[model samples]
Target: MDTENCTNLYLQVCQTFLTCKYDDPTTFDDLYKLLPWLRQSLTCCVCANVIVDPMSSTQSHCQHFVCGKCKGGKMILRPQCSWCKDAEVFETNQHLVVLVMCFKKICQLIASSPIYEHILNYDQQRKKELAAMKSDSPAKSDTPSKRKRPQRKFARTYVTSSLLNIPVQQVLQDAMNLKDVDINTQPPTVECKT
Candidate 1:
């Protein structure tokens, strides 16, 4: 598939995987927690979401990066830096953009793999159980204060493996190393952080 189409599909699958409520919270928690650092490092300061078309303030001291949405929507840098109070212009941060793209690919791979399919199956089963419980207590259905069942936590490795019913590490390693990706061509200046 084309790059944009592939990205959108991966994002959709990731969204579906995240929304499912697992019976054991750690079934995916340990493995999934590794993905968010990509966003935290390169996201817009204004919207606080993953940066799309990343641009940074031109001021020397505070070159805070902001996403295109924040730049065009609110005019965050009309007169001064919204973050550092300096009058500055926006400049394209190609390095940050490259970094974001690379990490996004890694995340997409993990999200679009067998683990996602496993979650889908588990969510279906969980939904059926919830439906049966609701039917059994019809009077409590309309109550906003209905009690929720407490989910017990299990060992991360054990839970993750049991959920997938497979060798988790081998599958994850295979997913991460799916294709020949050469991100080493990034410019040396890419190391600079916002």
Candidate 2:
């Protein structure tokens, strides 16, 4: 009816439409279409109020909602209708965890929901697959196969001018002496001064 109500309804309606078409959200176009509808449907669930500013990134992108009762105060996602805080609601009815895992950061959460369960079903499935693979492993073989060929000798590389044979520091010192010979060694410089 009002702008807020319109936004919430718009959200539900847009979700339904996009879901019907392609809810998989494989491409940007689906998200684009949904976003416009999402913005239109940006209404508060509690007071049936329209969201003028849904905070960061706007109503379409952000999920935070405001109700008329708290006087423009913020509340958690999907809170109780009457009170901004979900104190009266039972733990199972109120609590829910959203898990998001990335390459390095693995996020997990505990949720209390009277309606739905949140155990990681995929992890259990993966463990079962690993166990099956372990069980189906091939046994080790003891007997050697009758395969032989002419063996070539392996030649090891020798260090001819190594530090052990000729001290590298001494060789460098000798080279330095060759470059910088004393004046007594006979290549004397003649200084001409006025």
Q: Which has the greatest lDDT?
A: 1
lDDT of 2 by residue, 1-194 (tens): 13344345444433543343222323223322332233323333333223321212122323334422333443423322343344222111100111001100110111121100212232354457878998999976778658857552321111111212222222222222322212223322467898
Candidate 1: stretches off by over 4 Å:
1-30, 72-83, 118-194
> Can you give the lDDT of residue 130 in candidate 2?
71
- Considering summed lDDT, which 10 consecutive residues are worst modelled in model 2? 95-104
Against the unseen true structure, what C-alpha lDDT does each candidate score?
0.50, 0.29
TM for candidate 2 is 0.17
Worst 10 residues of 1 by lDDT: 1-10
Candidate 1's residue-wise lDDT over 1-194, tens digit each? 12243345445435645654545545565444333323334445555445666677666556566765576444232344355543236666666565556555655655565566654554566568868988897473665656777654433333333434333333343334434334454423345578
Per-residue error at 173 for model 1, in Å? 21
